[model samples]
Each structure stands twice: as structure tokens, then as C-alpha cells.
Target: MVRSEWTKVWTTPGTAWLLITMVVATAGVSVLAAAVTGCPDTGCTVDVAKVNLTGVQLGQAVVAILAVLVVGGEYSSGMIRTTFAAVPRRLTVLAAKALIVTGVVVVTAAIAVAAALIISARLLPLSLGNGTVLRAAGGSVLYLGLIGLLALGVATAVRDPAAAVGAVLGLLYVFPIFGLATTDPDFQRHLQQIGPMAAGLAVQATTGLDTLPISPWRGLAVLAAWAAAALLAGGLLVRLRDA
Candidate 1:
């Protein structure tokens, strides 16, 4: 049953389009950023990896939609009942979906991040061999994959694709906007530290450490916490609710 579900996901037209969108969006954004933000003659001071992967912010929305549709679409179409009938175990079905979705998204994200970083490194004045560049590129991929999982979980609980997509996008983007809206430096700093985008993007900061709002790894961790919490809530709801 799990294998069947995996095949269905890959063969689905929506999944195919979403995967293409992810790749195109990630690569295109990286190229545009590189072209617009060239490095200085003395070498770039900006985090090249981060700049290249900037598309992830937009790309993640597609991922969230893809994740939501995996299950939410089924619910909307009344196909979930057939799925439950075939599998007979709600937790197992959810686990299988989560694992398959995570695996696919992670692999796609990793490739996109790697290609973006490599292409940007060549176009920009920065070197890809730098440790910081590696961390940012790799972490961006992981961060995106986790975001997919979080969206999947949310979709499971909501059982509505439109609502799940809106909720996930709001969760991911709202905090960052709120942080920017605040006038207080201290409060803004705190919000940046906790906000998924502000914090997650910290991994891409390779310059001005003293001026940074938070450490890169710590920022990624904050995003991870959000993803984990969403997944947990979704899991609980899935276990408690009807198919």
C-alpha cells in the first residue's frame, strides 16, 4: 500500500508540475540574485550561498502546496476513504505519506540547492569551497524539506487543500512580516530570532557575525521546531479523527 501511494505521488500530474516549479524557482532566483548582487573586486562579502538559495523562500510555497495536496486533495475528492479502506490503519497511512513526501522533497531540494550554489559561485566573486557556503547550501535544502513535512502534517489535520495551503503559507511568512513591521529594535530582534524566515535564512549569513540577529544553525533549529510542532499536532489529530 505504501509503495502504491509512493507511485501515485510520483505519477500524479500536480506533483510533477510542483517538482518542476521547485527546480525552476530555486535556480532562477539564485541566478537573478547573483546577477544583481555581484561580488566586489576584493571578493564578495555577502553570503553567496544564501543569495543563491534566496529562491527557497518562494520555492517553499510550492512545496507547501505540493505537500498539502498529497493528502488534502484526496480528502477533497473523497479518495481518502478508499485509501483508508485499503490500508485500514490510519497511522500507517499517514506515516507512509509523510515518509514518501519528505524523501521526495528532500532529494529535490538538495539537488536544487546544490545546483544553485554551484552556479552562483561561478557567477559571483565568492568561492563555493568555503565552509560557510557549504553550510548555507546544505542547510537551505534541509530547511525546505522540513517545511514540506510541516505542510503535509498541517494538511492532514485540516483536510482541506485551500485552507491548509493558506495556513502553511501564513505560518511561514507571517512572522517574518510581523518582525519587519515592529518599530522596537529589541522586539524586532526577538521576532527575527524566532521567525522562521528571518531565523532560517540566518544560516546564509557569512558576514558581519557581530551584527547578525542570530547564529545560522540556531536559526535553522528554530524553523525545525516549528515544523516538528506542526507535524505533532497533525499527527495527534490524524490519530483522533475519522478518515
Candidate 2:
């Protein structure tokens, strides 16, 4: 089942194109950001790691769309019914898609993040040996992977490509906008603590850790929890609804 899903993902040209675009968009934005930003000889307080990985903010959208298409496309094309018929166990099918989608997204993200780091190394004072930088880089990759899983689960539950994409994007981008619009600091902080994008991206912070609403690792855990819950809900819904 996993092999079948893997083949389906690679055979799709749009998915491949999006993966390439993810790498380019991520690396390109990082380069642009690093070019404009600077640090002093005395060392700066700016979170250089986060700045260099800034392209991730855009790259994640692509990841979310691709993940949505993974399942939603099947539903749109009426292939999901055939998939369910062949697999018999609906949960197994979701698991397979989740595994394949997460695996591919993580690997592609690793490449994209590495490319961003390597290209921005000269523009920024990036140290490969620095543990903080390492953690930020590693965490950013995991962040994109988790975003993919979250989108996949949403697509599974929604079963509509356009609506699923909108829903996931709202969780990622819109929620933060709402947080920013809020007047209450406490409510805003609470929103960041639970928001998938805001919390997940916190893992990329290498400085000003004292001010973060949630710690880096803890923020990533928050995103993981969101993904897990989404998948659980999607699994139940998939079983309850007809393809």
C-alpha cells in the first residue's frame, strides 16, 4: 500500500513541480533576506537562523497545498473510492498516505533547508558547528514535515481539494493575522502557543529565546499535537463518511 501511494505521488507532475518550487522558493527567499540583513562585529541579537530560514514561511504554503492534493486529489478524481475498495481497511489507507506524504515532505524540506543554509552561509554569520544553528535548521525541516501532515489530515477530513487548502492555510497564515489584530497581549500569546504555523516556526528562533511564548522544542511539540489531533479526527471522519 505504501509503495502504491509512493508511486502515485512521484508520477504526478504537479507534485514534482511543487517540490522543485519549494526548494527554489525557500532558497531564493533566504538569499534575498540574508542579502538585506546584517550583523555587527560585536555579534548581533537578531535570530540569524530564523532570518536565513525566512523562506520557510513561503515554502510551508507549498507543502500544505501538496499534502492536500495527496488525498484530496484522489477524492476529486474518484480514485479514493477505488483505493478504499482495494485496501478494505480505510484507516490503513490514510496511514499509508500519511506515511508517504510525511516522508517525502521531510526529505524535500531537508534538501530545501540545506540549500538555504548553504547559500546564505556567506551572506550571514552562519556557523555549521553552532548547536543553536543546528537545532534551528533541524527543527525547521521537521516543522515543514509536520505542516504537511497537518494539511494531509485536513484534506482527508474535508475531502475537497480547494476547501482543504483554504482551511489549512487559514490555520497557518490566517490565525496569525488574527493574533496580530488582537489587542490583548495574553490572548495573542495564547494564540501563538497553539497556532500551527506560529508555534511551529518558533523552532527556528536562535535568539531572544527568553521572550518566546513557548520554548523551541515545546513549540514543535505543540505543532505535532495539532497534527496528531487532525489525523485522528480525519481517520474517524474517513471511516464514517463514504468516499
Candidate 3:
């Protein structure tokens, strides 16, 4: 069943393109970010990992689209019926899809994140491969993988490509907006601590941990919590709803 799901994903058109886009878009944008933000002097204070890895802000949207199309596209075309016919266990089907999507996104995001880290690290004079730098680099890859899982859950729940894509992007962005709009400092800090984007990106901070709303690994755990909740909800819905 898992292999069958994997084959279905690879056989689909635009799958390869989206994966390539995630890698290329991440690497290319990160290169530009590093170039423009490159330390021209010894006193610059940019968060080196965060600076180059900012491309993830763009790459994740592509990841969302890729994930949406994986299962949601099947529903839009009525192919899910065929899928259900082949695999009677709906949760297993979703689990397979989740694994395949995570695998692909992780591989592509790893390549993109590694290239971005190397290129961005070069732009700064700071020594690389510290624990913080390694965490930022490695966490960015895991972050993308989590984004893929979240998207899969949203798409499975929504079951419409357009709606699922929109919902995923909205989920990714909306809380950040809320976090920024309020005037109360305490509330604002709490908002950022919980917002998926704000908190998850904390792992990319290499220099300003003292000022961040949440700790790096803790923030990532927040995003992981969100992903787990999404997958659980999606899994239950897939089993309860008729294909």
C-alpha cells in the first residue's frame, strides 16, 4: 500500500516540478538574500542562518502546493475512488501519503537548506558549524518536512486543491499577522510564541536568542504539536468521511 501510494505520487505530473521548485526556489532566494545582506563590515548584527534561510518563507508555499496536490488533486479529479478501491484502509492510505510527502520534502529541503547554509555562512566572518549554526541548518530542513505534513493534513481535510492550498497558506500566515497587530507586549509575545511561523522560525536564530519570544527547540516543538494535531484531525476525517 505504501509503495503503491509512492508510485501514484511520482507518476503524477507536476510532482517533480514542484519538488524542483522547492529546492531551486529555496537555494536561489537564499543566495540572493545572502548576497544582499552580506556583512560588509565587522560590526554587522544579522542572524546569519536566518538571513540566508529566509528563502524558506517562500519555499514553504511551494511545499504547501505540492502537498495539497498530492491528495487533494486526487479528489478534485475523482481518482480517490480508485485509491479507496485499491486500499480499503483509509488511515493507512493517509499514513502512506504522509510518509511519502515527508520523505520527498525532507530530501529536497535538506539539499536546499544545506546549500543555503553553506552559501550564507560564507557571507559572514563568523565561524560556522557551531551548535547554533548546526541547529539552524538542520532545523530548517525539519521545518520544511513539518510544513509538508501540515499541508497534507489540511489537504486531506479540505479535499479541494484550491481550498486546501488557501487554508494551508492561511494557517501558515494568519497567526503571525495576529501576533503583529496587537499593542500589548505580553500578549504579542504570547502570540509570537504560539504562532507556527514565528515560533518555528526561532530555530534559525543564531545570535539573538535572548530577545526571541520562545526558545529554539521549544518553538519547533510548538510547530510539531500543530502538525501532529493536524494529522490526527485529518486521519480521523479520512476514516469517517466517504470517498
Candidate 4:
């Protein structure tokens, strides 16, 4: 099942394109972020990992879109029936897609993040000593992979390419929009604590940890919960629905 799904993913034209898009967009944005910004004050505190990895925000959208197309495209093309006919196990099919999607996203995202940080290594202040840099780098990679999983689950549930893509993007951005529009501090903090983008990105912070709305690892856990819930919902729907 895994091999078949893997073949299906690689044979898809957009899979390579989307993965390329993710890497280029991530590295490009990181380069731009590093190029445009600098130390403005003497007592400056900036999260180098977060700054260098700013491209992940853009990269994640590409990842989500890619994951969406992996499943949703099958529905759009009426190929899902064929897939299920061959596999005969709905959950297995979804699991294989999820795993393949994660594997691709993780590899490309890791490369993107690594190259971004390396290229911009000169631009950063570099005062974040000890394991902070390692944590930030590792966490950023994990965050992108999880984002892909979240997108996969969403795509599996929605089953339509356009609608599933829209839903995934909404999940990534809507809470942040509401958080920005609201004036209530408590509400804003709550949104940040739960919003996948706001919370998951916290893992990339190498500075100002005390001021974060949610602890770094805990914030990541929130995202994990979101992803798990999405996948579970999607699996249920897949099991119940007609192929």
C-alpha cells in the first residue's frame, strides 16, 4: 500500500512542482527577510531561528496545497474509486498518503530551512548560545512537517481540490486574522495559544521565551492535537462516505 501510494505521489506532476515551490519559497523568503532586516538598537533581542525561518509561513501554504492535491486530486479526477478498488482499505489508503506526504514535506522543508539559515548565518546576531539554535532549527523542521499532516487531514476530509485547499489555508490564517482584529488582550492571547500558526511558530523562537503566549513545546503540542483531530475526523468521514 505504501509503495503504491508512493508511486502515485511521485508520478503526479504537481508533487515535484509543489515540493520545489516549498523549497524555493522558503529559502527565498528567508533570504529576503535576512536582506531587509538588521540590528536596529544596542539591546536588541531577535529570534534568529524565527527570522531565518520566516519562509516557513509561505512554505507551509505550499505544503498544505501539495498535501491537499495528493488526496483531493484523486477525487477531482474520479481516480479515488480506482485507488480504493485496488487497496480495498480506506484507512490504509489515507494512511499511506499521509505518510508519503509527510516524508516529502519533511525532506524538502529540512533542506529549505537548513539552506536558509546557512545562507543567512552572516546576517544574524548569533548571540543565542547553547542548544537554543539547535532547538529552533529542529523545531522549525518538525513544525513544517506537522503543518503538512494537518493539511493532509483537511484535504482527506474535504475531498474537493479547491475547497480542501481553501479550508486548509483558512485553518492556517483565519485565527491570526481574528487575533489581529480583536482588541481584547485576553482573547488575543487565547487565540495565539490555540491558533496553529501562532502556536506552532512559537517553536522557532530563540529569544523572548518568557513573553510567549504559550510555551514552545506546548504550543507545538497544540498543533499536534489539531492535526490528530483533523486526521481522525477525516478517517471517520472516509470510512463512512462512498468512494
Candidate 5:
């Protein structure tokens, strides 16, 4: 069942487009950032990792669409009934879908993030030898994968591709915007500490540790928590509802 579903996903036009968008957007933004920015000699240079991965913020919308379409597409076409009939076990079906989607997203994100980092290293003045760069590069990939999973979970719960995609993107970006809009530095800092985009991107921060609103790893962890919670909620909905 898993293999069959995997094959279907790869063969699907939407999946192909999603994957291509993810790769292209990531690489394109990284290249642009590298071209536009220069590294500083004293303070932490323009975080090459962050620059290369800036596209992830935009790429995540594509990931969300893909993830939502994986399940929601079937629902929209009334094919989920057939899927449930064949799989029978609701939990198993959801789990299989999650695993397959996560696997693909993780692999693709890893490749995209790594390529962006390597390109940035060559194009930028910063030294790739720094441990912070390596961590940021790896973390960016993981973050993209997690965003995919979160979108998948939300889609499962919403059961509507358009709504799911909107919700996921809203969740990822809205909070960050809210953070920025606030005049209170403390509130903005608080939002940055907990907002998914604001917090998750913290992993890319290579300098100004003391002045940062939140620690890099902790911020990423917060985003992970949001993903886990969404998945848990979606799983509950999947288990309780009828197709």
C-alpha cells in the first residue's frame, strides 16, 4: 500500500510541480541573497545559511500545497472513500501518507538546503568552515521538512485543499507579521520567541547571540512543538471522522 501510494505521488503532476518549485525557489533566493549581500569582517557575517534558506519561507507555501493536495485532493474528488475502503484502517492510511510525504520532503529539503548552502559558500565571502554555518544549513532542511508535515496534518483535519493551504500558510507567516507590527519591543520579542517563522528561522542566526530575542535551538524546538501539536490534532480528527 505504501509503495503504491508513493508511486502515485511521484507520478502525479502536482507533486512534480511542488518538488520543482521547492528546489527552484530555494536555490533562486539563495543566489539572489548571495549576489545582493556582502559579509562583514567583524560581526557575524550576513548569515549565509539564512540567506540561502530565505527561500524556505516562501517554499513552505509550496510544500503546504503539496502536502494538503496529497490528501485533500482525494477528498475533493471523492476518492478518499476508495482509499479508506482499500486501506480499511484509518490510522494506518494516515500514517502511511505521513511517512511517505515526510520522507519525500526531508530528502528534497536536504538536497535543496545543502545545494543552497554550497552555492552560497562559493558566492559569498564567508567561510563555510564555521560550525554555525553547518548547523544553520542542516537546521534549515529539517525546518522545511517539519513545515511539510505540519501542512499535511492540517490538510487531514481540514479535508479541503484550498482551506488547508491557506491555514498552513497563515499559521506560518501571520504570527511573524504580527510580531513585526507590534510597537512594543517586549511583545515583538515574545512573538519572535513563539511564532513559527520567527522562531524557526532563529536557527539561521549565526551572530549577535546575546542580543537575540530567543536562542536558536530553542526557537526551532518551539516550531517543532507547533508541528507536533497540529499533527496530533489532525490525527484525532482523522480517527474520529468518517470519510
Candidate 6:
């Protein structure tokens, strides 16, 4: 199952292009962010780690689209029926896709994050040896992987390319808008605590830990929970519904 899914993914030229776009988009934005922010004096307030990795906000959109297309593409091409005919167990198919998507996203995100870090480091004094910086870098990679899983689950559940892409992007980008629009501080904090994008990105914070609505690792966990829920819902729906 895994091998077959891997082949299917690689055979699509768009998949390769999307992965390349993810790397470029992530690194490009990070470089631009590093260029605009500076801390020449002591006691600088900037979270350099987060600033350099800022491109992730855009990179995630591409990741979500790639993940959605993984499953949604098959459905659109009428190949899902053939897939099901080959493999009677629907859940296994999903599991294989989840594994492949996670692997590819992690590897791609690692490359993108590394490029961002390296290039951004040239602009800012980034200490790769620092424990906090290391955590932020590693966490960013995992964050992207979990996001891929979240999108895949959503795509599987909806079984529509356009709708799946819209739903996933809305879930990631819309909540922050709601948080920013409201006047209530407590409401804003609550939204951040529950929102996948806000919470997940919290891992990038290198300073002012006390001010965040959720802790770094805990914030990533919130995103992981969201991904798990989405996958569970998708798995159930895929099994119950006809392809």
C-alpha cells in the first residue's frame, strides 16, 4: 500500500512542483523578513528565531494544497474507485497516504526550514547551538508535517478538491482574523489557544514565553490534536461513505 501510494504521488508532476514551491516560498519569505527586522543594540526585543521563520505562514498554504490534492486528485480523476477495488480495506489506504504525506512533508519542511535558517542567520545573529533556537527550528518542521496531515484528513473527508482546499485554508488563516478583529483581550487569547495557526506557530517564539496564550510544546500539541481529530473524522467518513 505504501509503495503504491508513493508511486502515485511521485507520478504527478504537480506534486514535485508543489514541493519545490514550498521550499522556495518558505526560504524566500524568511529572508525578506530577516532583511526588514534588526537588533543592532543590546536588549533587543525581536524574536529572531520566529522572525526568520516567518515564511512558514505562507509555506503552510502550499503544504495544505499538496496534501489536499493527494487524495482529492484521485477522486476527481475517478481513480479512487480503482484504488478501492485494488485494496478492500479503506482505512489502510488512508494510513498509507498519511505516512507518505507525513514523510515527504517532513523532509521537504526540513530542507525549507534549514534554508530559511541558514539565509536568515546571515542577516541576524542566530545561535544554532542554543537549545531554544533548536527547539523552535525542529518544532517548525513538525508543525508543517502535522499541518499536512490535517489537510489530508480534510481532503479525504470532503472528497472534493476545491472544497477541501477552501476548508483547510479557511481553518488555518481565518481564525487569526477573528482573533485580531475582536476587542476583547481574553477572547483573543482564547482564540489563540484554540487556533491551529496561532497555537502551532507559538513554537517559533524564542522570547516572552510568559506572554503567550499557550506554551510552546503545548501549542504544538494543540495542533496535533486538531490533526488527529480531523484524521479520525476523515477515516470514519471514508469508511462509511461510498467512493
Strongest candidate by lDDT: 6
lDDT of 5 by residue, 99-208 (tens): 89889998888877777777766766555678987788778888887888888888999999899998998898888788878899889888888888888888888877
Winning model by TM-score:
6
For model 3, give the 10-residue run with minimal summed lDDT.
Answer: 120-129
TM-score of each: 0.93, 0.96, 0.95, 0.95, 0.93, 0.98
- How well does candidate 6 match the true structure in TM-score terms? 0.98
Model 1, runs deviating above 4 Å = 41-45
Off by over 4 Å in 5: 38-45
What is the C-alpha lDDT profile of model 2 across 1-243, one tens digit per residue?
999999999886698899999999999999898878756455666778898999999999999999999999999999988998899899999999999988999999999999999998778867877999999999999999999999999999999999999999988887699898999999999999988889988999988899999999999999999999989999999999878
lDDT of 3 at 119: 73
In model 1, pairs of residues that clash are: none
| Per-candidate local distance difference test | 0.84, 0.92, 0.87, 0.86, 0.82, 0.94
Sort by lDDT, best first.
Answer: 6, 2, 3, 4, 1, 5
Q: Write the residue-wise lDDT of candidate 4 on 192-232 in tens digits.
A: 99999899989888788999999989999999999999999
Clashes of each: 0, 0, 0, 0, 0, 0
Worst 10 residues of 5 by lDDT: 38-47
Candidate 6 residue 185 C-alpha distance from true site, Å: 0.2
**Pick by TM-score: 2 or 6, better one:** 6
- For 87-142, candidate 1 gives per-residue lDDT tens digits of 87787888898888889999999888877777766777566778877787788888
lDDT of 5 at 76: 93
Candidate 3, clashing residue pairs? none
Q: Which stretches of candidate 6 lie over 4 Å from their true place?
A: 41-43
